[model samples]
Target: MRVRRAAKGVGDFVVESIGEAVAEVVLGVLACALLAGLALIAYLSWSFSPLLTVAGTGLLSLFLAHGAWGTFRDPVEGRRRRGWTAVAAVCFTLVAATAAFLLLYASDCGCL
Candidate 1:
């Protein structure tokens, strides 16, 4: 009975940890997107430098990629099959979507 309780506690901790990680990443991405969008609007209307536009988009893309990698890594980093959380899955999905959008924008291909 003691071993079972210990195992359950560990699993709960892992899941809670995963949730916190996912929430942080989501909040980060949302905040960045909002700020970036505002900056982009300002740049477009205020004749901000072309270099700044490129740099801003590049940085945002890198950030999204890192988030995606981190979220995916969190699931299978240390152990074989300890725990799985819906937050991790949701995080991956969100990151993947943002990454896909970036790919299309970078490629400038409508079909992509």
Candidate 2:
């Protein structure tokens, strides 16, 4: 009886862990999709306006950087998920660089 109970508990734990991992993966994918959609919409709406494009990209970069900072600062999450921290950092960096480039281009082109 004791052996069977232990086996069941272990199985349950494994299932729960897998479920949590799957949920996290799905949520991450959805978040990325949402961000991509927002970028596409911004591009379509602000294509002709350099300042507006810079504003949109800057806002997105700020949002990503904030998220990355939070992830890096969280004690439990920061320790448990180094990969996520790296991913967040990379995303923030890319978005920020894009925003900077857009701003520079706008200024240089006399569009600002």
Candidate 3:
């Protein structure tokens, strides 16, 4: 049996879905840019040190996380917060993972 809602428009549902998708795409792009900027900055310094890079990237990641949290709580898109939430989670994970890998690599090889 198929039941139709009495007052829902299919167009509205489609638009809302599209908006969610767009939000996710935007968040992903922003995250990538932030990560790439961090890496590029680290590479260009030529300090021959990972510590500086790690610290800089960590700071940038923290800033992004704060922005993400603000967006997540905004009233404009309460239902679509999931998209930005995923972005924030991924960004945090990537930053942590990169830091852990660098630390492990440095400790194992005595880079300091």
Q: Which candidate is the best by TM-score?
A: 2
Structural similarity to truth (TM-score) of each candidate: 0.41, 0.44, 0.38
Count clashes in each candidate, considering only residues at least 3 apart in sequence or on different chains: 0, 0, 0
Candidate 3 residue lDDT tens string, 52-93: 767876877776786556554555644554565667766766
Displacement of the residue 4 alpha carbon in candidate 2, Å: 0.3
Stretches of candidate 1 exceeding 4 Å from the true structure:
48-112
Clashing pairs in 2: none
Instruction: Give the number of colliding residue pairs in candidate 2.
Output: 0
Which lDDT values do the candidates have, in the order given?
0.63, 0.68, 0.62
Between prediction 2 and prediction 3, which has the larger TM-score?
A: 2
Minimal lDDT window, size 10, model 3: 103-112
In model 2, the runs with Cα more than 4 Å from the true position are 48-112
Worst 10 residues of 2 by lDDT: 103-112
Off by over 4 Å in 3: 1-8, 47-112
lDDT of 2 by residue, 27-56 (tens): 555555555675688778787888888887
Which of 1 and 3 is ahead in lDDT? 1
